[model samples]
Target chain A: MTHEAKTVSEQTRERLLDAAREAFSQHGFQGATVREICRRAEANVAAVNYHFGNKDGLLAEALNFAPLKAMQLANAKADGNPEVRLRLFIRDFMLMLLDETNGSLPCRIMARELADPTPALDKIVREAIAPLHDFLGKLLREIAGGKTGEAELRRCMHSILGQCLYYRHSHPVLQRLHPKLRYDHKKIETIAEHIADFSLAGIGYISGKTCA
Target chain B: MTHEAKTVSEQTRERLLDAAREAFSQHGFQGATVREICRRAEANVAAVNYHFGNKDGLLAEALNFAPLKAMQLANAKADGNPEVRLRLFIRDFMLMLLDETNGSLPCRIMARELADPTPALDKIVREAIAPLHDFLGKLLREIAGGKTGEAELRRCMHSILGQCLYYRHSHPVLQRLHPKLRYDHKKIETIAEHIADFSLAGIGYISGKTCA
Candidate 1:
C-alpha cells in the first residue's frame, strides 16, 4: 500500500478505537455493537473486523487504550514526607476516578467491567489494579514504620482505597443523599484531604504510634 | 376466590417473587426476563403480568424483598459507648454485605442498579441508603463529640462505609490481588474490626481529638 493509503488506514483504526472506547464505556462490552461503533467512527461496516480481528479484540485494545500512567507518575514523585506522598497519591487517584475533563473513559469502563465482568477483567487486574495496589501497599508500609502486620497494612490500604472508590461506585446514591455534593476540583481536593488525613490517623493509630 | 384457591394463588405469587429476586440479583433488571422468571418459578408465562403487573413492577417488589432490617437491629442495640456502637455497626454492615448464607441478593441487585440504574434507584436511595446514611451520620457525630462539621462527618461516614462496601464492590479484583483473601465469617470479623479501628482513628483525628 502507498503511504497515503496506509495513513488513511491508520486513521480509520484510530477512529474505531476512539468510538469503541466511548461505546464500551457507555454500553459495556456486551451491550455495544460493531455496527454502532462503526457508525460513530464513520468507518466502513467491516472496519472493526478488519482492524481488530473481532469485537473481543477491539474490546481488549479499547480497555488498554488509556494507560494508567498517572499512578506511575504519582509513585515517582515519592520524594518528600510519607504523609505528603500519601496525600498526593490520594489526590491523584481521586482525580483519576472523579475527573471528567480528564476523560473518565477508563474508570467508567472499569465500572462496567465490575458490574458485569468479561474475560477482559483478568488482564485489567494484572495490568492496572495490581500495580495500583502494590504502589499503595508500599506507601502504607512506609507510613506505618514497618511495625504494622502485613494483613493490617493490607486492610488499611483497602480502607483508603474504599474511601476513594466509593465516590465513583456510588455516585448516584450519593447524589440523592447529598444533592449538592459535586465532584468538582474543589470538592475533589476536599475529599482527597479528608481521605488523606483520615487514613494517616487510622494508620498511625493501628500502628500504635498516634494513640500511644 | 375460595380460601384454598387464594392460598394456592398466594403460594404462586411467593414463588414468582423468589424467582424474580434470584433472577434480578444474577442478571439485573434489564437482563432478566419475565419468561425466565416464570420458568424458574414453574408458573405460567403470563403470571408476571397477572401477579406483579409488569417487569418493572416485579423489579420494584423484588428490590424491596429484603428490608435491610439488620441495620435497624444493629442500630437499636446501640446502648453504651459510641465507639463500640460504631464497631458493631460496621460489623453488622459488613456481614450484610459479605455473608453468602445471609442471601446477598439485595447487595447484588443494588450493585446492578449502581451499574445500570433504572428509575427504581430513587426509591432505593430513599428507602434503604438514606436511612443507613443517617444512622451512620448520627453515630459519627456522637463519636466526634459534636465538634466535627456536618460535611466532615459525612465524609467520615462515607470513609467507613467505603471500607465496608469495598469488600463487596471489588471482590473480584481483591481476590485476584490476594489469592488467599476470603470473606468467610472469621475474615469478615477481622475486616469489620479493621474498618472500625481505622475509621475511629480517622474520625478522632479529623475531629481534633486523637492528635491533640
Candidate 2:
C-alpha cells in the first residue's frame, strides 16, 4: 500500500489496541466483544479481523502492549550502583504499577489475567515478566555479593517484588485498610524508599553483609 | 419452623455457599450466574434468595467465607514466643492460601475480587482483612519491641504479608518461572520458614534489634 495508507492502518491498529485494553480490563477476555471494541475504537467491524486476524489475536497484542513499553522505560538507565539501581528499579516499577493517568489499563488487565488466566499468560510471563525477574535477580545478586544461595536469592527477589506488587494487586484492600493511604506520586516515592530500605536490610541480613 | 426443617434449611445454605464460592471463584462476581450456582448446589431456584437474599448477597457471603474461616485457624494459638508465632502465622496463612484440596476456592475468589472489586470488598476488608491486619500489626509490634514507628510497622507488615500473598496472587507466573516448583506440604513449610526468617531480619534491622 501507499505511505498514507500504511500510516492510516497503523493508526487504526493503535486505536484498536487502546480500545481492546480498556474492554479487556473492564469485561475480561471472554466477556469482551469484538463489535463493542470496534465501536469504541471508531473503526469498521472488519478492521479488527483485518488487522489482528481475530479477537484472540487482538487480545494477545493488547496484553503484550503495555509491559513492553514499560520495560523499555525501566531498562533505560542501569548504570548506577546496585543499591541505587535497586531503589530506582523499585521507584520506576511502583510508578508503572500505580500509574493512573492511563486509566491503569495495564495493571487492571494484568489483575484480570491473574484472576482468570488465558493461554496468553505463558507468553506474557516468558516475554515480559521473566526478563524483569532476571533483571531484578541480577541486581539482587550484585547486592548480595554473590554469596547467597540460589533458593535464598530467588526468595529475596520475590520479597522485593511482592512488596512492590502488593500496592497494585491489593490496592482496593490497601485503601480500605488505610483510608488515608493513597498512591499519589509522593506516596509512591515513600513506598519505593520503604521497600528498597526494607529489602536491602533483609538481603544484608541474609547475605551476611552490612547494608551500607 | 420445626427443628428438622431448620436443619434442612441450614444444609441447603451450606450447599449454596459451597456452590457460590466455586462459581464466583471461576467466573468472578459479574460473570457468575445465580442459575448456574443453584444448578451446582442442586437447590431450588429460589433457594439463593431464601438463603442469601440475591446474587449480590451471595457474592458478599461467598467472598467473606474463606478468609474468616482461615482467620479462626490462624488465631487459634497465640501464646507462643513472638518469633514462633510469626512462623506459625506464616505457615497457616500460606497453607490457607495454597490449599489446593479445596480447589483453592478462597484464593481464587479473592484474586477475582482484587481484579474486579465489588461493594463486597469493603466488608471483606473490614470484617476479615482488617482484624487480621491488626493481629499481624500487634505481633509485629511485639517483635519490634514497640520501637518501630507506626508507618514503619505498617510497611513491615505489608512486606511480610506481601511475600506470603505473592505466592498465591502470582501463582501462574511463579509456576511458569519455575515449572518444577510445587506447593506440597514440605514446600509450604520451607517457604514459611524463609519468609518468617527474612521478615524477622527485616523487622529487626529496621527496629534496631538483632534477630536472635
Candidate 3:
C-alpha cells in the first residue's frame, strides 16, 4: 500500500477504537453490536474484520488503549523520589479510572472481567496490570528503604492499590454509603494524596524507617 | 397455623434461600431462573411467591443472609481491645469472603451490583454494608485514638477493608499473579494479622503515636 493508503487505514482503525470504546462502555461486550460501532465510527463493516479480525479483538484493544496510554504517560514522567513517584503513579491511575472522555470504560470492563473473566483477561493482565504492578512494587521498595520479603512487599502494594481501586470499583456503593464523596479530578487528587500518605506510613512502619 | 406447620414453612424458606444464593452466585440476578432455584431447592414454583413474594425479594435476602451471619458471629465475640477486635473483624470478613459452602455469593453479587447496579443495591448497602462500615469506622477511631475526623477515619477503614477485600474481589487476577496464595483458615489468620499490623501502623503514624 502507498503512504496515503497506509495513513487512511490507520485513521480508520483509530476511529473504530474510539467508537468501540464508547459503545462497549455503555452496552458492554456482548451487548455492543459491531454494526453500531461501524456506523458510529463511519467505517465500513469490512473495516473491523479487516483490522481486528473479530469483536473479541476489538474488545481487547478498545479496553486497553487509553489506560495503556495513561500508563505510558505516567512512565515517561516517572522520577527519582519514591514518594513523589508513588503520588504521581496513583494520580495517573486515578485519571485512568476517572478519564472523562472514555467514561471509565477501562475500569468498568476490568470489573466485569473480574466478575466473569473472559479470555481477554489474560492479555489485559499480562500487558497492562502486571507491568503496572511491577512498577508500583519497585517504588514501594525504594520508599521502604530496606530489605522486605516478597510477601510483605506484595501486601503493602495491595494495600495501596486496593485503596485506589476501591474508589472506582465501589463508586456506586460508596456514593450511597457516603453521599458527600465525589470523583471529580480535585477530589481524586485529595484521595490520591490520602492513599499515598496512608500507604507510606504503613510502609515506613513495616520497613522500620520514617517517611514524610 | 400450628407450630409444626410453622416449622416446616421456616425450613422451606431456608432451603429456598440456600438454592437462590447458589443460583444467583453462579448465574447472576437476571440469568438465574426461578425454576432452576426451585428445582435446586426441591420446591414448587408457587412456594417462591408464597414465601418471598418475588425473585427480587429472594435475591436481597439471599445476598444478605451469610454475611449477616458472619457479622453476628463476629459481633458476639467482640471485646474492648481495638487491635484484637480489628484482627477478628478482618478474619471474619475474610471467612465471609472465602467460605466454600456459600462460594462467596455475597461478594460476587456485590461485584455485579458495582458493575451494573440495580434497586437491590440500595437495600444491600443500607441494610448490610452501612452497619459494617460504621462498625469498622469505630474500630479505626479507637486505633487512631486522637482527633481524627470522619474523612481520615473512613480512609483508614477503607485501607483495612481494601486489603481484606482485595483477596476476594480480585481472587482470579490475584491467583493468576501469585500461584501459591491460598485462602485456607490458617492463611486467613496470617493475612488478617498482616492487615491489622499494616493498618495499625498507618493509624499510629497518623495519630502521632509510636507503634511497634
- Candidate with the greatest lDDT versus the true structure: 1
* Number of the top TM-score candidate: 1
Pairs in steric clash, model 1: none
Q: Where does candidate 2 stray beyond 4 Å?
A: A1-7, A23-39, A44-47, A64-77, A101-108, A209-212, B1-9, B31-36, B43-50, B63-77, B101-108, B145-147, B209-212
lDDT of 2 at A29: 84
lDDT of 2 at A103: 60
After TM-score superposition, the amount by which residue B153's alpha carbon in candidate 2 deviates from its true location, in angstroms, is 1.9
Name model 1 segments beyond 4 Å from true.
A1-6, A31-35, A65-67, A209-212, B1-6, B209-212
Tens digits of per-residue lDDT for model 1, A13-118: 9899889989987777877889999999999888898898888888888876244666656566777687888888888778877887667577668866764657
Order the numbered candidates by TM-score, best leading: 1, 2, 3
Minimum summed lDDT over a 10-residue window in model 2 chain A is located at A64-73
Itemize residue pairs with steric clashes in candidate 3: none
User: Second chain of candidate 3: TM-score?
Assistant: 0.79
Off by over 4 Å in 3: A1-16, A26-54, A65-77, A101-104, A209-212, B1-14, B30-39, B42-54, B65-77, B101-108, B209-212
- Candidate 3 residue-wise lDDT, A64-131, digit = tens: 54565566566657786778888788777777676564365676667556645566888778877787
Q: What lDDT does model 1 reach?
A: 0.81
Judge candidate 3 at residue A99 and give its lDDT: 57
**Which candidate ranks first by DockQ, i.e. highest?**
1
TM-score of 1: 0.89
How far does residue B134 in candidate 3 sit from its true spot (Å)? 2.0
